[model samples]
Target: MRMMKMTVYFDNNATTPLKDGVKKAMAEALEVYGNPSSVHACGREARLLQDMARRNVAAMFGVRSEQVIFTSSGTEANNLVLRGYFACPENLEKGSKLVISSVEHNCVHKTAVDLNRLNGVSMHMVTVDRNGIIDIDDLKLTLEKGNVGLVSIMHGNNETGVIQPLDKIVALCKEYGVRVHTDAVQTAGKVALSFKDMGVDFMTVSFHKLGGPKGIGAVIMKADIDMECHTSGGSQERNRRAGTENIIGIAGAGACTEEWQVSVDKMQNQIGPLRNKLEKGLKQLSNELYIIGESTNRVPNTTNVIVPGLEGETAVMSLDMAGFCVSTGSACSSGRVEPSRVILAHGIPADEALCALRISLGWQTTEAEVDAFLAAFGEMLGRMQKAS
Candidate 1:
């Protein structure tokens, strides 16, 4: 049986298809050929382009130009907030406590653990419901325990497409006088984010997730909050992050963000219907296939299905053979054979978590691709089950 490979991409959460506009903007940045740090005309021009991109990225979050501090990636941005925030001399001595949601991306969760092990910082985790929504009541109770300096929650669950109720969490954190940060890497361009409205002390955004180039991201924080520099040496990014910026990647991200803001609704309109069609198709596949967070409000582009009687990695490989790209968890962690920690955090049994497959849509996903994937997936699942 010569089954010619038919590629259908459903792994946008791992990384999106590079947008044409973003590529063009990044190409233009190469012509500016000046050190953003230098005082010469070329340097000044580079600086101008960087600032313009910074302002545009900030605007994506409804934030001020000064608040967006560029970093190497969203992981770096998360590290800056978690580590940099505690690196403060006064705060370090206080034995400050930081809390993150149980289902946080590895960057946030691992950083918290490292801070606890290396710096002796106090850390806590607020649990989430089975649908992967942050347990607000549990969070309030944790805050009420007092001495919690910062609470980090992600705006969207990459695997499950579950969006946290950040407004309520922010208001609760404010009441407790604890700083709050959100890993918004998965949500920024996919949904509307109002920095002024959600009112968290810090937010992390990634470029690749915006359908832009990788290797660049930014942390948008309030004006009043100050942290020791995450990276030391020359003063760049208002003495916050100290590295020569990724001028090209920043330019691409800026262009991507701008394009998203203009056409977000169109993207969603296309994504929503296709996602619904896919989900409907999955339901028809078998009664045992469960879409995690099916009952809740999920970001339009993601679906996590627990295919019983199949290993997540097995399903991923089978789908790959069938010409569909999907994942078991965050791309960073998917290479390993571990069950999803995010799924485990939701109290799903380890076995079920190991069987979960995440299918994430993107701006460029077409109905034909969805239809193709559904057909291939259903066939693959049937074969896998028959073998069992």
Candidate 2:
């Protein structure tokens, strides 16, 4: 008789499990079927739910509720800012360039490409170092060239968990009077975040990356930023985004955000130690193993490991067979045969990038589970190395 392997989840950075409070809120919201646009009693109740969610999300970001614009996903939120901000005639004036980091999520990178290809907008990509941190000098030189309207960078990388020096980046951009945007999807609930402190013009976050339901994200814009509306329909989201709000997802996000500080404390106090333990165990398992961004300041729950002589997809399969859930890189970029673009952007060779694995912890991860995963990974790697 074979014993069943206990299921272990280490892919929280891809998408986290919904918290109990979020589930309860979403369940209650499901009963609210009335359209928020209508002025009847039912519609008023629906609108109240959305309004409450809006307020809760606003409180998490330390911003006014009016500054939060809900969108379908983080990708849509990023597009709204990149596309909508550039849509303004003033921003699109000749020679006005959009500066982005080379390691941005595909949403930001692809959108920048489309903006350049379709709209004839100028784009400059700042490179990153081996640790996946953006080069501050490259950014400063690009801004010095003049004609930059906005600078978009991610707060913490989803794949490598590397945290960028937003203070330095923001301060430099401020000196040049250029707008800045950061995708904070992976950092919002896990780290202490202050919109006012970061001093960015716009920030994007996805609820599902935390404990909220999917299909809902928010773009936190500074009060003074003038961005044109991309989607035109209803007057929802203060006319910034025009669509009937997703009440269920919003309710979940609201409940999740209401307890944001608690989650941050847990991540820092609980998950960080577990991640450190996993990294130490992985290094001890083999001298050939490498942990990406290990020395850099990274998110508490994420560890990106490079296992020599093994492909990430193969390891993912073997781990799945052993009842472990992990990821090769971003969930958005999964299924492609190519290596991670984010890793390649850091000057890592494509072959090494293909061998990388991202393990992200969460609120419920345990020491025993981490140890078990280490054992399983070690065994699988030994077998793969022998075969190679």
Candidate 3:
């Protein structure tokens, strides 16, 4: 039987395809050639567009419009929170500690490392369970050690799709009088977020992950938390972040958030069935396939499966050539062939860690695409089995 030809995309956790509405919104904004900071009618028009974008994003997080600060990307947002917070005059004292989870994205991990190297800051890493969730007791033990400046925990594990117990962590932080900062990049649009309810001191989100344009993101800070400005310039973002904003990208992010608010139910319905289909097909291909974090609560559209005796990079390449897009681990470090830190953190052997692959579905992923992937994936696995 001849297999059907298809171009299947399953790397939404890396980045998503821009929606038509978001593209249209960005195109419309691009026609307005005016700096938002200039004192003129054109500038006022641009400023209005920017304000609308802020309000749209704020609505998604249930925060005030002024509380959201736009940045170049999620990395910049993470840097601003990690570096900017400790650099503030109020927090510039010695012996300040910063705690982050073991499975954090490189943006968070590298930022912490850089701060420790340069600023004499104490960096603590919170351990995670086999399910990729931060061990709350360990976090409390770390918090009790000293004057904890910040607690940076991710809402969702980008690699394993495990959702952390954020509310419990936040409550514990409050009891200890510690400030919390959550990297909600992966969970922003896919899961429900309420700034008022989450009660974290700061939160970061990226637009590219949510079907919006790249190079634009937002950091939501509590109104009272005084963070030093990372980029100093004219009074934009209420003097929180500097530089003329990417107006078109901001507009696109706003459109994406608005559309998500209205169509979340539809998206949930569409992606869940496809994820289940992929999981079932992969398990049938080989019972030895270990699904990491399967016993824990995970995002609806992400699956991390370990194929024994096969290198993840080789499998990823084979699948890519077969017209299926997936990932070995973090897309930021995809070029490297090292075993994933996320998989290793789950107590998987170092050699076994090299066998993990992550397949994440998204809005444009269809049933036909998933079916095509299964057929190609089965063939690929059969070849690997025979060679081994």
Candidate 4:
């Protein structure tokens, strides 16, 4: 006589469960028993493992090994780009402005806010369409105002999963002689990412987004770009990021990178169908339900649906009670009860944003899981409507 566990995770955009084999590699890394900075044999062993991980992850993203600098998380990687550039004492005095998209991750958005408040960093917010696509004309107009040293945007949005036209954005910035950086955390393992081919000056990725361990991620910078270090302490990350490296976490990330394509293929073939089925089923349940970025190109794993007449957080809680995991907005801001700023950025009414429910799928999702979520969601909507 046992009770069944109410668990069906659909929030991969927030974070993913560790990939198979990552645990063993990370646990073994702990036994290395050496500081990578030391010059002895034990230290060399740890350094070798660290080098191997750096090379493996770099190879996976089609970038040079030297360009990758590991950070504590995707958040740090992002802050490194936003804050690191502004850390230059002379740049702040020169009034170098940072142009950020309205739909960017909070790490980027909030860091920009702090820089403007603390330092004299000027900030400009670019606009996005209803489909969550960045407006190139708006960006061009902003850059034309001058003193734009760096432009920060994301390759794939975490909330709506809308894939930005990075190539276009990069080209546009190049014409204005500005460096471009993209938060590519949500793109890994869900789509093919060629860091160099994308033609971006700076791009970052999260290990956990690719089914690797959490607290380990990297920012890939192009050659000739002077990266001002943010985390200062003893020399590490080739004198880029400071403090002791997360060796165990990096090892797990390397293991995941070694077999990342298995995840990509699974997302395309398996998870894509599940998403389509889920969307189709939701449509059948109610015509009032529609996706935020439905008409645009998005990663196969994410679907941000706005269920009219129901509060998103309430729907998320009801589904959680029904053995499913979904989110009202970005997990970084999950504690807040306000409507999604990303949705509001689309120029929709504030009330529409209150109905947003972001359900992201992953490699481990199955057909049965999708069916169960759809059924539970339909029932909840039916009850909510009936009571109304």
lDDT of each: 0.86, 0.90, 0.87, 0.87
> Worst ten-residue run, lDDT, model 3?
329-338
1-388 per-residue lDDT for model 2 (tens digits) = 9967449988898888889999999999999998888899999999999999999999998999888999999999999999999988977663368999988998999999999998877899999999988899999999888899889999999999999999999999988988999999989999988899999989999999888888999999987766888888988887788988888888898999998899999999999999999999999988989999888999999998997668898899999999899999623336567888898898888888889999999988999999999999989978977887
TM-scores for all predictions: 0.95, 0.96, 0.95, 0.95
Superior by TM-score: candidate 2 or candidate 3 = 2
Best by lDDT: 2
Judge candidate 2 at residue 107 and give its lDDT. Answer: 96
Per residue, candidate 3 scores C-alpha lDDT tens digits across 74-103 of 989999999999988687563389999989
lDDT of 4 by residue, 195-291 (tens): 8788888888899987889999998887676667876688898777898888998898889999777878888888988899999999999888889
Q: Candidate 1 lDDT (Cα, whole model)?
A: 0.86
lDDT of 1 by residue, 71-114 (tens): 99999999999999998967665438989989999888999999
Clashing pairs in 4: none
lDDT of 4 at 305: 92
Best by TM-score: 2
